[model samples]
Target: MAKKMLRSVLFACLGNICWSLIAEAAFRKLVTDQNVSDNWRIDSAATSTYDRGNPPDFRGQSCMKRHGTPMSHVAWWVTEEDFTTSDYILCMDESNLRDLKRKSNQVKNCKAKTELLGNYDPQKQLAIEDPYYGNDSDFEVVYQQCARCCRAFLEKAH
Candidate 1:
């Protein structure tokens, strides 16, 4: 039998420990609930090296647990291969969007359409703020935003 094409998506942020991690987890759950997990590849990465090799923030973990969304991820920076591979490089905030676009241009065969994840938000929120400096409530807000955006994104994917 012929293999199905896998659509690659890379979620990115200044630090992979917060917003991006939430996005990756939310999208993963959305696809799993839809039973289309096998049709897509989802990953999260940072635009900066500051949080590279670290795990998702504790607040984010707590938020996920509160939402019953299972998520485990180690932070890493976006690479040239990621630029050339992902169909969509979705990011939180203008900083991440600018960083990814700048990095994408450095790669000759960049294929990913880098854009703000909030672009998919049904509520018209234009940016998903980094909750690293905030408390658990901030993380919860991030989770809610990610869930909304991810759901909209999946719907549009179909």
Candidate 2:
């Protein structure tokens, strides 16, 4: 029998990745603001499922709940083994980059780049700065930066 194919993909964040909340919000915005379908969606590790279905509210529970955390939206706290196996990985900081690099060395197929998506300065490979420790202004900058990169990714994919 043919194996099942994953429709959506996972998003990687930096240490512990509380930022997935931000990434998921951005994902929702990307779909709604960009008019994309929910069929190809992104969710948090707190809400994904391999069986495929509607998203649930695991707000108060750990990702290891009975429903099982879906790989499509793995949190940054996920193990390196899990992160390396993802179809596409997005990191939020230099530390995330280092971990991914280490894992990538071990797993040759892990081609995730620190650059948000595949688009960048081409020869430069710029990484969007982490805004996890700044004021509203910094968050705005990070949001704008993420929006730009995400739009590029969505445009090419859609």
Candidate 3:
């Protein structure tokens, strides 16, 4: 018998309060539901320090609750260590992708492959827009997008 390798993933957005948090929660649910939670490491961070150390946005939290997804992540900014540690550095939109790429470039021998989480969307949606200032309905949009993209990504990963 051989031990399985564990893959790590870090999701990111501009502030880590909405889009990224939703994506992280969605991905976790997928992995857990598939009974592969032990095979992966998952977390999320912000490309900027805008909401560092804060809880996820209220509307995003409410949206997750409505969908029965659990999220308890405290906001944090992306670090050089993340570039080296995660196998995949997935982000919400173009701005996050750019920021992760730039930060990864600064780390010698960066190991993570940073990409837009929406790149895996079966519907070909290329960006997951931030819903920070939007209403609950906007948060619902983000949730739906994250669910679709995360499922696609997980299926491809396996």
TM-score of each: 0.96, 0.56, 0.97
**Best to worst by TM-score, what's the order?**
3, 1, 2
Tell me how far the alpha carbon of residue 136 in candidate 2 is from the true structure, in angstroms, after superposition. 1.2
Q: Mark the 10 consecutive residues where model 1 has the least summed lDDT.
A: 96-105
Candidate 1 wrong stretches, greater than 4 Å: 1-3
Quantify all predictions' global Cα lDDT against the true fold. Answer: 0.91, 0.46, 0.90
Tens digit of lDDT per residue, candidate 2, span 1-158? 86435435445555323344444555556666655645454544321223233232233123212223221332424344544455555655555556656666776455433334324223333465545465545545545555566666666655
lDDT of residue 79 for candidate 3 = 91
Better of 2 and 3 by TM-score: 3
Ranking by lDDT: 1, 3, 2
* After superposition, candidate 2 runs with Cα above 4 Å error: 1-7, 16-20, 41-76, 80-85, 107-115, 118-125
Worst 10 residues of 3 by lDDT: 128-137
Say which candidate scores most in TM-score: 3
What's the TM for model 1? 0.96
Model 3 lDDT tens row, 105-145: 89997999899999999889899888877899988998898
TM-score of candidate 2 versus the correct structure, residues matched by position: 0.56
- Model 3: pairs clashing at backbone N, Cα or C within 3 Å: none
